[model samples]
Target: MSVNALISNYFTTGALSDLPSDHFIDGVFVPSERGNRMESFDPGTATVFGDFAAGTAADVDHAVSSASAGFALWRDTPPARRCAILMEAARLMRAEADWLAVVESLDSGKTLTEAYGDIHGSARLFEYYAGAADKLDGRSVNLGNDNAAFTLREPVGVTAHIVPWNYPTSTLVRGIAPALAGGCSAVVKPAETTPYTALMIAELLIRAGVPAGVVNVVTGTGQEAGAPLVQDPRVRHVTFTGSVATGVGVMQAVAPNVTGLTLELGGKSPLVAFADADAEAVAEGALWAIFSNAGQICSAGSRLVIHRDLHAPVLELLVKKAKALTLGHGLRNTDMGAVNSERHLAAITAHVEHARSRGVEILCGGQATSDPETGKGWFFEPTILDGLSAQDPAIQQEIFGPVLGVQVFEDEEEALALANGTEFALAAGVYTKDIATALRMARRIDAGQVTVNDYWAGGIELPFGGNRKSGFGREKGLEGIDAYTRAKAITLAV
Candidate 1:
């Protein structure tokens, strides 16, 4: 789509029938300086969804400069007015919800339900932060003599965000939502593979009355554009959501500037099913645990620990459910879908192979299926592995696929220990009817989000983050809104 048409459709809310091969800079869609391009493949058909200008370091600098320049005015744009703009953006997002889903499914192998839900979820974030925009008030502090003191929540100028490909559209929204709400300007470097949705989102932001340079997106390889953006001194804050390794590297890259950091990184979240829990509900939750988005979520329930007394029956039901899923494209109303990319499929397969070598027992389907109707798509069987201890390699690492490693425990002490065995502390669940047990585990579990007799995680209105090695800082909820702001104190005396 040409710039003219894109802007025209920005108001018309047409289908995502046209994709412009460009990066967004200074609120305008433009071609990349580096003529090199990257092609996004549709996981459903292994077809080219679109090609985008592969951004370079210079492009990152250009975006950062524009955002920084824009910040001088945007940061001071009264909170009430900023809220109006973001609220408009949220409304615009809802208006184009169908188009957003289509673009997301094409660019990211997202299921219809997930792609559409992501758009809705993202819109909620905008709406939520929009309301909180003007609510960012500083409280007064009492002091001796005739003195007045208080604090102000100010925007950390020129923030740079590096969002992951798995949930690019939403993750970028996670950062951009609060930045815009907090009256800050941002330069976003979206994942190279899934740049289309980001471009489309930038268009919505512009239509919502966001001024030029308030938000810009540059896409490229992480080693170049992502790293440079993080390292840039002008970026007062850096927000990233990806792997632990990448987050560590980004931390080191941004260390020189004392930049504010918010990282929503990887996870090996545990799902524990106690004997007292409802068997049917537990089995169904386990299915949702590792199969949603083909288990692309960082907080996915990849590890399932069941009580030994009920393990056999639960395992039988789980295996049966796992094998019965229908694998196809994300567009249809199917039980399952293709993996996101060739690289992700390869990694999932490698993890399964590694588990098999480590004397793990495969309880069900553990291989990939290439159905032509799905277009040589990368669909993997939802796998369950028994004969694995908490210390098993599969249990200790984040496979980020549909591979669930089951570990049996005799007591609550063992369950908690096993759940916390991995370095990741992103998310975990305890399924138990006993309120005491649920409360105990909720307090003891080394995870950011803990649920009782349920599989609740990832919501725009909830605070999501991790403890220990799972990375730091919160995204979503009020903390997420505050994460984009820097609190400053001011004092006055007569």
Candidate 2:
């Protein structure tokens, strides 16, 4: 079926009348400097559906120059005016939410429900930051004597945003919203796997009164476009969401320039269920945490650390639930969707194979699927594994698929040790009826974000990020704006 036909039947709404063509940079849909093109594949069909201009290093340089120039004007624009424009952008985004959701689902191979939720979250992020635009103020410091001291919060100039493909729509906006709110121009490198939504957003921002060059998007490989954007002297801040290795590369590229950074990397997050926890509820939480988006999520709770007494019941429930999920095309309103791409599917399969070699028990699903109804899409069954040690590859490394590894803990101490064992400290989940124990575990876990009694207990209002190898800096919430701004001290003699 054609992309349009698929969306028209599945979306049952006018989300996207048609997909946009070309990249948006410097207020125009211009061809790439390299004049190269690449095909975007639909993971559901394992077939190319759209072609996009492949960005180059030259494009990145031009984008940086444009953003630097645009920042000069935007930095001086009144906060109220910036806020107004951001609010308008939010309105426009909500107005086309259905279309945007469809495009996002098509590009990223996520379920339509998940894609729409991400679109809504993106709009809410803009709205939240729009309110913060005018309220971003520095503090006044007291220095004794006849001297008066105060500080002013200012934009950090041009920012480089390297967004991942899994949650492309949300991640792009998550970075852009705050940077724009702080009056910083942005050079965004959208994941080549998913660039359509970003392109349309750039156009909408311009229509909402964002000046030319304020938001430039380059779509291509990280080496050609992303690296230059990070290394460019003009980019004052860099925010990236991807694997740990890529995040490290971004850090190295931006180190010489002393550019500010917000890195949201991968995680092998643990979901702990205590003896007192509800087995069904914890099972449900684990399913949503890891199986959602086919477990491509960075903060997916793929590692389950359960109390010895509760492990069997929770494991039983998890196995049953895993086997029951209806998997097919993302647009089909199925319980689960295909893995993002074939390469990703292969890596996931390898992990399971390695686990088997290590004598790990396959509690439930473990292999990739060839669903007749789903055709050639890269689909993996929601899998659960048992008898894996803490150091096992499947337990330690990030599979980034619908695979969950189980670990039994005799007590709170053991659970804490197991939960905090890995270098990753991204997000963790705790399920227990005892409020005191939940709070205690939340504090002990090394993860940046911890959920009590549920997998995702917080919303956009709360700050989220990771520590250690999971990467530093926060996204979402009031603290997020700080990533894009700097403080300047001002003093007056009285």
Candidate 3:
């Protein structure tokens, strides 16, 4: 069916039909023990579309217990059998990519195209981990003739995954795929606003031969559901992706148990352009860096630091392109889409307004808007603010919106300083033809991942994470699987 037809059939009068409203636990949908429900809004229209279980401490405990039991069974299951199950899950994900993309767009207010890519990435994550499942081989150490030594990789037991709202399916799968591949069963707590896709993914895993209780989903507010899951001692490992404040909270909650943790917090990453760089390529790269997904990405290149000689032309190009971006419903496949919710729209507005009050130049848009046709969505204009100092709040803080801050630098040293000014060291981008300059910046930049010519150059195979206040540990690629595993060294006399 066409995309419009599917939307019309499922979403009528601001209410969705056949939505997954209950938590998926023990391979079945179950109501929360508290019997509470929270309404989820359609950010495109700013109206209620569905409600999901308001998970509480009791619900979290139940899910964790189920995961613990499943871990016992799954960890003992042969690696080959586990590999087959994960491969089948990836196949199911591919078969339902279209439907899953639609659901993701509805829940997260991202463009249909971006949502489609997210679904594809999600499937690829499962596929990648599946390929690595049976290959987690231990290495033997060469010792004296009468002595023998080897190492073993083992699952860290039941794990808790606290998924953020933005990039719901992608982030959820990014963490859990490796956990499952490493033989750990998981209890997931999806952001309340975007829980539908998490539940749906769990259901798909169950259908793909993941045994009962191997994957569970609980949806609710962070304070109630997330804290409990993180604090649960039965959960031996925790994977969380969100704000630095919350990531800190996760660390505190896990402190008593000393549980293993992996955190991918947010970033105010930079896109540095040199005077010798191709202006056209830099403009295009800058556009995709900051505005893709309406600039809600943790790795979004929100700060543009360019040489003084090239700033004006690049700024003009960026303003022209940013002004022309179309915004509306995600299903409409516009150039941009709504910011996740009304609250988020307000936050973006506040940041822009604060910058403007400080006499910063508002090069283009600086106001909140709505869907031009329906006039109801929580939308914000693509914004560009200039004349900001290195310590400006707009430059240092993670606005988590489509607002780009521009700064000019005179030379390579100044550019490097500005790019690495913020507490976030998640990701950065460098655009220059000079190989030596690119190599120097790549080595000196504090970010975990630095792309030389492109803002987001790598794929699912690359390792991704952050440093300093942006949180620690890595996700994606082989390093991702390592987070879910514990290493044990063995020695013996033969």
Q: What is the lDDT of residue 59 in candidate 1?
A: 90
Query: Residue 471 in candidate 1 has what lDDT?
Result: 89
Q: 1-494, model 1: which lDDT tens digit per residue? A: 44345434532442345675687999888777868788777777676756778888889888988998889989888889888988899899888887777677657766777887889889888999999999998889888768899998888788888888788788989888988888888888888778888888887888998889989988878887888899999999899898998899989988999998988888999899888988888888898888888888999999998889768878888898998887776665367667878888999999999877877899997897764463477888888998587778898888998889899999999988988899999999989999999999989999989876668654677889998778899988888877678789999976
Q: Give the worst 10-residue stretch by lDDT in candidate 1.
A: 6-15
Q: Candidate 3 on 1-494: residue-level lDDT in tens? A: 65676788755656656679999999999999979999998899998888999999999988988998899999998988889998898899889887888889999999999999999889999989999999998999988587889999999999999998888999999998999999999999998889999999999998998998989999999999999999999999999999998898899999999999999998999999999998888888998898899999999999999998889888888889999999999878899998998888999999999998899999888999999988889988888888689999999999999999998999999999999999999999999999999999999999999998989899999999999988899999899999898889999977
Best of the two (1, 2) by lDDT? 2
Candidate 2 achieves a global lDDT of: 0.88
**What ranges in model 3 sit over 4 Å off?**
10-12
Candidates sorted by lDDT, best first: 3, 2, 1
Positional deviation of 342 in candidate 1, in angstroms?
A: 1.0
TM-score of each: 0.95, 0.96, 0.99
Q: How many backbone collisions does model 2 have? A: 3
lDDT of each: 0.84, 0.88, 0.91
For residue 443, model 3's alpha carbon misses the true position, in angstroms, by 0.4
Model 2 spans > 4 angstroms off: 1-6, 9-18
